[model samples]
Target: MNLVALAARCRAEHDYNPLCDAIPYVRFLGISVSEEAGEFISQLAFRPRNIGNPALPALHGGVVGAFLETTAILELVWAQETLMIPKIINITIDYLRPAGPVTTYARGTITKRGRRIANVTVEAWQGDRSRPVAIAHCHFLLELTP
Candidate 1:
């Protein structure tokens, strides 16, 4: 299945985004996307393998980082009409709070998009949207091919 095509269908149908299934890691993490009031929201459900500190029983920081990063990439893809695959330039992540063993959600906003680069901001929250567990700023190199 072509994820770009799936995403387009979802966008037109105003249904769930199935593009996450095209990425193995994202599927392993149980990431899913939904549209809410014209906004796209990403979610990651709690899983045992995602636990980092077994003592704290909190999610691994790397897992959270990947979640945010992947969210940004998908957001960029959804923004454009073409099937462009973005390469990561850099990602800066800030862990604000411990992510407990609970379903976490992420939302990404494209700050800027140029001819070759795109800047995205993503936030991950567990219990409350206002209280984000972590935030990430990512720069991606766009594949501007015909």
Candidate 2:
């Protein structure tokens, strides 16, 4: 489906936020989002395009970083219910282990939120949540809607 149509469907459902689906980079990465109750979950499908090393066939660090950042933004949008997109201030990512060629999952938590800024913690795991492939801490400058 086209981005506009997908976004319209998302709005009609009033569940998952369409901001992630609307972005071209997120779409290129093939990210899928779902919301259960108030919690948000994002998934990255395993694809050859995402592979960085031909030897190990591991996921690129950039892809994982983008996934985590997207997760943070999606979580913030879902929690705040705002139309304005948040500007990322800083992102610190720690690569824990190699991300194999498999479906990866990411979850972000809004640790703190103020008037103009919010801190989010995100973790991406392939096989187990207890052992994350990468973790990221992101600070975003929120734009408030009038």
lDDT of each: 0.85, 0.84
Q: Candidate 2: where is the Cα deviation over 4 Å?
A: 1-12
Across residues 45-120, which tens digit of lDDT does each residue of candidate 1 receive?
8999999999999999999999999889878776762356588899999999999999999999999888888899
Residue 70's lDDT in candidate 2: 90
Worst 10-residue lDDT window, candidate 2: 2-11
- Count clashes in each candidate, considering only residues at least 3 apart in sequence or on different chains: 0, 0
Off by over 4 Å in 1: none
Candidate 2 lDDT (Cα, 0 to 1): 0.84
- The count of residue-pair clashes in candidate 1 stands at 0
lDDT of 1 at 14: 62
Q: How far is candidate 1 from the true structure (C-alpha RMSD, Å)?
A: 1.7
